[model samples]
Target: MTDIADLPFAMYDAFTDVPYSGSQAAIVLNAGQLSTENRMRIARQIGVPATSFVDRIEGTTVSLQFFSTVMELPMCGHGTLCLITRLVDLDLLPCDSDDWHNATLDLPKGKATVKYRRNTNGRIEVMLDVATATFAPAALDMDRLATLLGITPDDYSSSLPAEVASADFIHLCLPLRDLDAMNRLQPDFAGLAAFCIENGLETVAAFSTDVIAVDRHLHVRDFCPAVGVSESAAAGTTNAALAAYLFRNNLVKPEGADLFEIRAEQGLKLGRPSQITSRIMVSDGDITRLQVGGIATRVIEGKLSLPSPDSGPLSQQ
Candidate 1:
């Protein structure tokens, strides 16, 4: 067994009741000595879409950083949610007591407060208060995007034009006309990499309404070669951006309620079948607040050894 002192961390994948179904990442709670290079190296070694490192802070807040396999990002929803859940699990916070209801996370972009609550079924659910979304028009290179995705221009939905939106990082939203077209999408990762590099896009969110039940709506499928995520099972920030897209385009009529709730179904094609619930408040056509919540299941817990910074690549370890 590896020495506990050398391990220095525990990791978990949230929102997946089944093992290997949802996204996974490492969690470094006491990230005092770890440098950015080390973090990225570990994240790349783990091979998950995003990993989180936490530094305890004063009050109910904790400092956090998110890293993908190749780079560090401003913020990540799933990684943030997983870190908070792990905190509660480790007894780092009073998860079983009343004090567990709220905790704040200090991310690179800003402060993101998380709330924990139990549903009627007695399952733990987490809610992350995220930043408001911003929308701007960008030339939709349908030919290039479709070429990279191996789809045609006719696949996109007529009601919604492809555009870039942001809650944390920028993502291009492409609404497909049907589920078949959405399913038919087989992206050329190399092509997508080149397209995103030249176009300055971080990610592409391609979705269809065919899977959406009229009673319960959903935001699905976050594919980004830029971030090295082929398909994100559940992306809260993207959901927030979708909500803003809906409200801005008058797709959903918002009355007195500032908050809008919707279900996000993802990982179906991948056979994981995950669900995410998101809520956002918009006033005067401006998003004021956003929150994404879901249940998390602990799949695996283990430790890994790393080479010292001077030891060159981790593969040697």
Candidate 2:
């Protein structure tokens, strides 16, 4: 039997200063001995959209795995942010040292380097410098999207056009005319799931900039019924992709600004309002780097006791 005390884990809500506003992710700091089935079960038990397992590997590199409620993902934004925040909070990440400001994380997808910097407000933000965005022309059924979202094409006219894009994961982008159209959304989960399956997409990101609120320029809703994430608390990768979309269309002046910043608010209707702030640096019509960051609040900390290998009929709750 595995000792429960040694299997302790910590949970944090990323992207929010408040206790429960951001996306919740579980972190198993020492997951070296856990099996794949055990990890999936633990994630499902946690009931969050995603969870992260961190294992200290050779010489200052940690191996990380991100798992959704259903399965493992190649990469995830909030999970990465949550893990790095925990590391910093625990003093595991060297803060005072000059060379410690930046570190490379080995994820399932590839090696991603993150830099820690303090903003003007004295808030520490972790910038995960993502690779270039990948775009390809793909067809979408706008009517199906409207039907699933309970909106029409007329509601999105002012936003001008919709398409499919993938920064890390492929999502169908539907631009709405105003926040009112977005607020009116009540997606049919089953319908959306079927559509995603038929179209070979991951999620549908319906967004608009017409709705401006405190410290925010855009509002977005990410729906991923296919992966069992009906709605994300905050989606960092998609928001970064959105920044790329804006710059690609020349909608924003990216060069002269301190940083091209955009705030994405989500999970409001579900009573778990979360916020994600993303920035990008563009030079000579090319995005040099991308950073998505936010605060993380610790929520729960506990451990799991595994049954003995010889124990009969292991029980799960």
Candidate 3:
């Protein structure tokens, strides 16, 4: 019989400084030797929308694999943020507390950069620089989208139009008139899932400029039913896409000549309030790069026992 191994894992609520709020993700340490099947099983057992498997930590570079409850994903934004926070909190990275430290993430989709440092409040701040997304007008019917979200056509924002944005994933961006419209959203999950799959979309991001916090630029709610997540408390990639959409449509003005920073709030409806900071770098007249980052709070730490190879079918718990 093969000996079972125990893996250490930590759960974190990403995109919030509070302990229990924000989106939750699990980071499995020393998961390099685990097989793909084992990784999938582990993710399911963690019971989170997304889990990060640490493949290797080499110098200032970390290789990671992300798996959702259902299947593997190219990359996970909140998961990456949580992993970076955990690494810095554990003192695993080589860095000085006062200065910003740069790290590279080797993901299944591609390589990205991360900058982190211990802030004045003694909390770690992680900034993830990801690929700049491209936008295309969605061909889907507006009336159908309104019905799918259980909202009326009048609730849609005329100023900010709908578009399909793609970064690491594809998102259907829906602009609503106000926070009341955002609050009234009651999506048909099964129908939304089918709609996403047929439309080659991943998530539906409904957003409004009216925010709860005076400092926040936008408020968003992301629904990812196709990936088995009915709604995400906080989604970095989806927010990044929203940021790009705002810039592309000239909705937000740059703070400086070449940089624009957006404070986005999410998850109030779910009560797991999250804050995401998205930074956009513009060159000449076009947006060049996008970065999403946030503070994460560690919630749980435990060990997971690896299942034996010869074990029968595992529980779907």
lDDT of each: 0.72, 0.74, 0.89
Residues forming the 10-long window of minimal summed lDDT in candidate 1: 1-10
Q: Which candidate has the top score in TM-score?
A: 3
For model 1 the local lDDT of residue 171 reads: 81
Cα error of candidate 3 at position 51, Å: 0.3
RMSD of 2: 3.0
How would you order the candidates by TM-score, starting with the best?
A: 3, 2, 1
Across 261-291, the per-residue lDDT of candidate 3 in tens digits comes to 9889999999999999899998887878789
lDDT of 1 by residue, 260-279 (tens): 77666777777766677777
Give the lDDT ranking, best first: 3, 2, 1
- Model 2 agreement with the true structure over 1-317: per-residue lDDT tens digits: 45223565788887877777778888887776667777787789878878887867454466878889888977778887777777776777756533327777898678877777555555456667665567654477777778888988678745456767776678776778888988888889999989998998887888887655666666888898888798887877777777677666666654355457767777777777777877777666577878877767788877765565445223222
lDDT of 1 at 23: 60
Residue 33, candidate 3: alpha-carbon lDDT: 71
State the displacement of the C-alpha of residue 189, model 3, in Å, after optimal TM-score superposition: 0.9
- In angstroms, the error of model 2 at 306 is 2.4
- For model 2, name the residue pairs that clash: none
